[model samples]
Target: PQLGGPIWADPIHDIEFVQKVLSAVSTNPSRFGTSKRIEGMLSMMTEELPDVPLYYALDHLCSTVHCNTPAMLQFRSALLHAGYRVSMSHASRNGLKTDAPPGVIWDLLRCWEKANPVKRERLSETSPAFRILSTEPTLQACFDVREDANPQSRKRHLVRFQENPQANWGPKARAKDSGGISSELEDKRKLCQNKRKNQVTDASQLKNFPCKRFRKGTCTHGDKCCYSHESASDEADKME
Candidate 1:
């Protein structure tokens, strides 16, 4: 429903696809630590999805307890990946400690300060949450464990984030729309291929939009290329 992409194609819905993996994580989250197998499984979603995942839908994906070292670091990394600017400011860092480990309010303030240091510093910072809300307002996961760092206790939290309609395509829609979505995805791939293919011949254009195949002159788009097919001299004259 948001910029994360359509349904299963986004990280906002990852908990749905990987519920089993998440469930396997126990209080000794170290039990299900980042192993080669887990990493490989995680890689599948990103490798298949268009771009790298922007943000993980960790909202409610944390335990009511406390976050352990691994969870804290991972949560911070998730915010960083989601384009949140983090700072090591005394105020922000100190503020972060008082709250659960997963909230990004302080990070949002850091981002705001970077963009408007003078005004931000000048203003009385009452509600950091309010400050965070004023900026780009999209709901993001801020899941954190209560007092326990045990991953097993967070199973329900993970499931909570999965209850979103965006995560569930509904059985009927899944059955009906699967083929259509696949077709659309294939069409997009071909379109990108053609765009890259046509970007050959013109070095400047190619640099800006390199073709995967045409770089080696194997572009099947040929004269049908959407990009300029100008030679070096021709390109120079055109630039002039």
Candidate 2:
């Protein structure tokens, strides 16, 4: 005898499993209404389904350069319209992972630049933006949003890229030693401060006494030597 309760079936080899499950739940509301587990399972299956590939094939598109005019949504829409699969990369908040070729990506960027014009005079001929904009796109790009432009994860409100847990959460400055003691290097730096500026330049202003190191032929300061390098005989002649 078949049970009266919900009969769970594995959606093996069923490409429309998600749609079928949703339909069944909607039609037989009382059967699934009492079960939170069923609801959560369906949610997970629909929204949390990972996009896996046999191998790493998608191209990563990220840049440190401050070109924020072309939003991710705009790029996604354009790529979708051009019949290419595109998604946000986990590596960066604004990064894109797509199967689209470099040429097509550049073309889309060119289209975006044309619509939202930038200061042409500011861009140099050698700059990437200028070079990309100079060339005409091979394919005419449409920024119209397609039904699939927005992924299921986004639509279901799944946590894609997590926000910063706390304010200013990133790389910090080097930690100082405990007890607020200044380091030996810092003490040495303080001692050496203004040493070059305080150095006497005029030979006449220098002390007539010869440097002991200069007499021993071991003085390293050369012309910048603060002490006089004159011999005892020269000093005696000067005294005379």
Candidate 3:
């Protein structure tokens, strides 16, 4: 006995329920199951004949459209009005031809624009598929063909970036989770200071260094590394 809300709603389970009713002959039969709720409900046993009731069943209604365009919602509404159970699924642009029939595509766009005037303009304007369709006639009839003919095709957009991508922290800006540049600089500064503070000093180390070049900030080897080494050498030489 499937004692549950789902059994009352789903149409496909009606036959299964009937089969279970016919098979269970004993008052207290062991029913193996996964759901704890189902197991607990099935544990109910009665010596007297129990009455079970059948309610409504569940089923999904759906429909398909050609092109899988942005005007899908509008098109779905039109089909629904014309007594068709329809729903839309996203498709890929690689399969769709660049030039689709203007009439059908335009009709879909018109209906979409009417229903959602604010969003219709430039909705698919910059899209690759739309751009190709707008300019080329070779693939004009592609959009007119029903999705069943070629179900995998869709419209998509491609964008290009010329500069380092700007991270637009909008009006409500929060610090990035990544430690900031200041924190990194501070860490580096601390590391440098610690390295200098814990530096080992010996007479052999002092003798093997160039002290003069670093004092004027012009060490021929490199500016940054040379400056620090030369500064240390100069201090050591002064001490000597």
lDDT of candidate 2 vs native?
Answer: 0.61
User: Which candidate comes out best when scored by lDDT?
Assistant: 2
Model 1: how far residue 20 lies from native, Å: 27
- For candidate 2, write residues 1-240 as lDDT tens digits: 123545334332243786687567657768854433343345444532134211111222222112445555767888888987776543445555566777897787667667766777888888766776788999999987776666664576644455576775655434455545443455556767898996767777776557889999999998788788888898889889
Per-candidate TM-score against the hidden true structure: 0.22, 0.44, 0.18
Error of 2 at 229 (Å): 42
How far is 72's C-alpha from truth in model 3 (Å)?
9.5
Give stretches of model 2 more than 4 Å off: 1-67, 167-240
lDDT of 1 by residue, 1-240 (tens): 235444453333354556556345432356754443353333333222232323333222221111112344344443455544322111111111212233454343334333334333433456443354346524344433332322321322222112335542443222233444332344545556756664357545544433556556777887667655555676577679
Per residue, candidate 3 scores C-alpha lDDT tens digits across 1-240 of: 135554432222244453465245222335533233232222221110122223111011001111323433334344344333332221211112212233433444434333334422443766543443343222112123244332111121111112234454223333346844332334445546756764656655554455466567656666334224545656778789
Global CA lDDT of candidate 3, please? Answer: 0.34
Task: Go through the candidates in order and give each one's C-alpha lDDT.
Answer: 0.38, 0.61, 0.34
Clashes of each: 15, 0, 9
